[model samples]
Target: MESLFSTMIVLLLVSLSCFTSSEALKSNKGNITIKWDLISWTPDGYVATVTAYNYQKQRSIPSPGWTMSWSWTSKEVIWSIVGAQTTEQGDCSMYNENMPHSCSSKPTLVDLLPSTPFNQQIANCCKGGVLKPGLESAFQIAVGNAGDSVKTVRMPVNFMFTAPKQQYVCGPTKNVRPTRFITADKRRVTRALMTWNITCVFHKAT
Candidate 1:
């Protein structure tokens, strides 16, 4: 009778362990991460890279999409996107042509693979992503709210990340290995602050 009781206790412990493990997987779903790296500034604008990674364990699949929003605190300066490039180049886009301030797109799809780090370079309002002295002065006057002068301007840029998509198996209802898209927590976003030293030159009061 004692042997039988020991076997029953072992079965009960196994069942509890399985249940706890399943709950842990469910709790890890929205742990995706994104950040800015490799930021180098130019007179025109800065070139930097943004990267996103999947931290979900059970769903271990690449993210379907991610987005970034740009806004600034400088009342005297304006920020714009000159261009951008992604790791999966064609898989992403600044789809909102009307509002290039924000960029959003889905990445290439694959099966049973760790998520690819989505990378992009954000450029300022300079031609060919370069800001020369003369061009820099022009951009300042065009976007700057403060009067033109030989003053040092610091533009603090804020990048807000949002709308992350997680890819996972949809089960037998679709196919042998069907992937589906699910919205993730918008609160899982990250931000970057960049300041540009813009020199504004204006003609003297004649």
Candidate 2:
């Protein structure tokens, strides 16, 4: 009886360890949204691209219960890193280049600024493009030159957001007549959360 009880206790501890590896505690449940940043996926040597995707997690037993991952519309997100572990978010920016990083886990986000300054920062993110989302619409700029063909690129999160207020340039001086995107109930996200993974898909226009 003693040996059996010890074995049960060991099994219970192992089960708990696996469960905690990925934050699935009821208190840790948080909603996450995903959007793509086109040209901006400029990590080194990365190629192929993600067109569309939806995130899903294991809903049953193996106990990744609260864990999840995304399925992309295109298989373009994968890449080959000659010999390095991906060190940053945009490390996998190209279609045929090797992806140095993996999204199999949560994205690394220490670079993300808080809502206020980031909104203000967006005013200067893009130099040559026009944003279509109105003030409601935001744009992402790739770190790579639009014309670079054989180099690897990595995207930075700042590529996904801008601060609503103008400290630098790029902030609009006039209210846009029509907003680019409005929520189902007609509300646009606040300038605060506006950049939370704000996606600006790419169009290689010729």
Candidate 3:
């Protein structure tokens, strides 16, 4: 009876620790707060500070042809068809009237920076959990040119940290990137590791 009681006590302590090992992120710009229970999961290193991600995408995969595999149907992601868009390239050196190629078959998906009447909140544990300056400093993702007929564009959102990067690299290398990933209903997020490097700084309300 004493052994069983001790085990229960231990479990109780663990549970308490799980909930209390906490961290939070407060927007420097806005007063909104992002809370995290770091005990269950947290960043690699430790520091006491607040940080935030503007947004994050949960990644998941369904069985092949789970619901028309060709179409993007997973509801786990916050997707917007025909998002705001712009063109930075591919205007063609000059118009080709003879063979005016119709690349309109592909869907042009654009990712818009999160804007809310209220600020969007992200949960980063400690100072270490913070992402990049340009990420929080400036809009992380913006603009795409998907073709017509492809009414929907699969926006790239990834789980994990997006390390500060200046140039684009190919494939899943350990670093920050505009990711092309999907999240399923099961919540098994893919390792589309996106990261940002921001040293969490805390300021109390005056």
Candidate 4:
């Protein structure tokens, strides 16, 4: 009887341990994810769209909104951007004409205001960085100096995202299946050349 009781206790402990481990794994899954899609090939490099999605059920990114920064793997430059803008246009003095938007290897970007001109806006953009639960914001960037083809282009690294009062831990970029887009008329379908994703989880700042 004594041996049987000991065995039962051990089984209960093992079951509890497994339950706790499963909960921990679920909690570690992030609430925010950022996706980068190479939509088109530009003469110099490529045009990509970066989108941040808020998956939290109750939380929302309030005004004075989110900011994202990432380091380029190579000497990539932002030729132009729509739906968002860099906080600083690093030194563009090297270009005599057709000035690049940002020259910094690590560029910080913020969403455009709602008052931004129509020509400067894109769908689901210019939201002032306020993201309600289940909503997403996106911006398009034309990158120069980076490779133009899938075999040559490089992915950015070390992405960092900041919300009004919250901090997030971003994961490394991962190559994912290309994204497909359908026209408004639903008559045509197109797909991105390549796609990558960076998932970030909300961690209360210590």
Candidate achieving the largest lDDT: 4
Compute each candidate's TM-score over C-alphas.
0.27, 0.24, 0.19, 0.85
User: Top TM-score: which candidate number?
Assistant: 4
* Candidate 2 local lDDT, residue 32: 20
lDDT scores in order: 0.30, 0.27, 0.25, 0.89
Task: Give the residue spans of candidate 3 off by over 4 A.
Answer: 22-135, 141-206
- CA-only RMSD, every prediction: 22.2, 17.2, 20.9, 8.3
Q: Which stretches of candidate 4 lie over 4 Å from their true place?
A: 1-30
TM-score of model 3 relative to the true fold?
0.19
Global lDDT for candidate 2? 0.27
**Per-residue C-alpha lDDT of model 1 across residues 47-123, encoded as one tens digit per residue:** 33333334434333223323333333433322232233222323114343432232223222111112212222222
lDDT of 3: 0.25
Candidate 3 lDDT over 114-201, as tens digits, reads: 3422233222211222333323211112112321111232222221222222111111212234233346666554432233232222
Residue 12 displacement in candidate 4 (angstroms): 31
| Residue 115 error, candidate 2, Å | 11
Error of 1 at 94 (Å): 21
